[model samples]
Each structure stands twice: as C-alpha cells, then as structure tokens.
Target: MLGRVNHIAIAVPILEEAAAIYRDTLGAKVSEPQSLPKHGVTVIFVELPNTKIELLEPLDDASPIAAFLERNPSGGIHHICYETPDILSAAEKLSAAGARILGDGKPKIGAHGKPVLFLHPKDFNGTLIELEEV
Candidate 1:
C-alpha cells in the first residue's frame, strides 16, 4: 500500500522561474539550488509547514524530465512520490498488480540520495508515481 506522500515534483523548463512563483506569489520559501547531473535535472525545494514542493527542470534535452515536459506541455505535476517503509516490497506489489514500471526493479538514487523507482502514468490514472523509502 502507498504510505505517506513524500513530495510532489513539478517538471518545469526553468527551475528558477518556477521556483520564483512559489517564493514570490505564494510566499513559499525555497532552498538552495541543487543540480543532479546524473539525473540531468536541477531541483529546488520549497519548504512548507507540512510538506515540501520540489521544482525540477531538465539540464539538457536528454533528461527524462525534459521528455516528460515535451509530451505533456501543460507541465504541472510531473510525479507524486509516496513514502514507503520498504521500497522493494512496494515496487513488487505494484508490479504484481499490473502497474507498468518505467525504471525496472532497480531503485536509482533520487533527491537526497534516497532510493526511488518510477511507475508509469498509465498505471496511476495517468499520473506518474514514484516510490521512495522514508
């Protein structure tokens, strides 16, 4: 079962501009910029009382997030990462339940170097979902 919501990651063409909207208009304070060259995306965390919002933008065209933005031009919510106690078990259940996994069984290092896996949008009512251990 899906546990807590880890964070909502939004895909943007420009992380700074998107971050500004949360900081300027919404008044959500943001963290320092962090670039994950491995993932080819740069992320900025918007801190809130309850949860955080991660604004992610591609560093290059080869970035998977870049591909996601091109396919979904609206570019709002990219993925919902749910916190799980056991990532492997969670991913197994998802696969057994017929959810197509985008990244296979391996858990790649995600934000903060935590293990993460991706489930295709088709399996989640067209919403991309990620599983991460808390």
Candidate 2:
C-alpha cells in the first residue's frame, strides 16, 4: 500500500531560521515558504537528492505546530510521509487492520496538492505517519 518515502516533516519554532540552516549551512535548495492554512502550518521544502525535507512553522497560536513547539521549544521531527498509489484503498486497509486515522478519517490536500491522510502515531511506534497519494 505504501510507495517510497515521501518527505519527513520537521516542526520548527521559526521557519526562516530553519530554512537558513538547510540553505546556507547544508547548501540545500530550499523552496519558497508556502502557507497551508488548512494544516495550520507555513512550510518550506528543502530539496534533497533522494527525498525532500519539510520544515513547518505554526500559522497561528491554535496551530498544531504551535502546540508541538510548546512541548519542544527547540522543535523536532513531526512526521514522516510515505507515498501511496491509492490513498483511499490504503486508508480502508489500514482502518480494517485497526489503525486509527487522524481527523475525520478522510484525505486532505497536502503540500504537494495531493490527497493525504495521517495515521495515529501510537499505531506506528510513536511516529506519526502521513500517507500521500502519489
């Protein structure tokens, strides 16, 4: 049901600073910041040879990233996304297998403008898993 690793998401206290580290220090190609209101995050993607790294900053105080930042002021890895050929089928299978889906248990438009769904971290060894339709 899963394809290759899509992108690993990191929640940061400040987006610009994080992007600068990846761009200036690591010499990576970082994409322009894009606000995802639905997800309550402003993101910038660091282009890598094999996979991309998604840097997320909270859009507002109520944003989930804001809550994450509160727990870890320095910020940290938030989630790992995996590509899926068919998200609906994958969601169905995962549900049947007793894996809880986050939110309304429906796919949402992700950073790549593709259908995506998040699975409960408890079901995935304490790591939030994002399934994005490729």
Candidate 3:
C-alpha cells in the first residue's frame, strides 16, 4: 500500500553549498549527510510537515543523478518517493499489474537508508514513481 509521499528528492551537483543555503539562508534545518553507495549519491534531508526534502549529490559519473543534472540546465526535482509499509510486496503488485521496473527485482537502499525501488518513467507516464520503506 502506498502510504504517503515521504520526500521530494532534488538532485544537485553541489550538496554542501545547497545544504548551507537551505539551512542558513532558507532556514531549513537539514539532517547529516548519508552516503547511498548503491545509488552513488550523498544525501541530506530536511524534514517537513507530511514529508521531507532530500538533496541528492552525485558521487560519480555512474550516478544517475549526474546524467539528470547534465540533461537539465537547472537542477531540480529528481523524484518523489511514496512510503510503503512493504516495498517488496508493493513492487510485486505493480509488476503483476504490468508496471515496468527499472531493475532486476529488489529495492535498493536509497538516500535515507530505506529500501527503495523506482518504477520506469515509461510505465509511470513520464513522472518517476518511487516506492520507499523506511
């Protein structure tokens, strides 16, 4: 079951600078950086009312966020993650219902140390869909 949107991830090239701006300038207190090695991103999260704002910085060329930043002149929203109680089951249901998943089958640990899986844009009608279990 999709519970709610946990966070909106924004991909950027300079995470530290962004963190400072959001914290000092914008007054959004952010969490400590957590490196998501699997996704090649170092993330910093800012808590909100019903959700959070996750700042994602690419660690290398292989990082998907790198390509995303390159494609868009202005870095922006990368994906919106919906929190699920059981990610595996949710993914299975989506697959059975014919939604295309990008990977081989299991949710990988995302920026928040949560199990996360992404539904293909082709299947999600251009808006990226993410399932997260924290």
The TM-scores, one per candidate, come to 0.91, 0.95, 0.86
Q: Whole-model lDDT, candidate 3?
A: 0.85
Where model 1 places Cα greater than 4 Å from the true spot, the runs are 72-74
Tens-digit per-residue lDDT, 1-134, candidate 3: 88889888898779998899889999987999988787688999987767889999999989989999999746788888898999888888988999987788678876567888998988776878888895
lDDT value for model 1: 0.84
lDDT per residue, candidate 2, 28-54, as tens digits? Answer: 999999998987999999999999999
Best by TM-score: 2
Using lDDT as the measure, which candidate wins? Answer: 2
The lDDT of each candidate is: 0.84, 0.94, 0.85
Residue 23 of model 1, lDDT score? 92
Clashing pairs in 3: none
TM-score of 3: 0.86
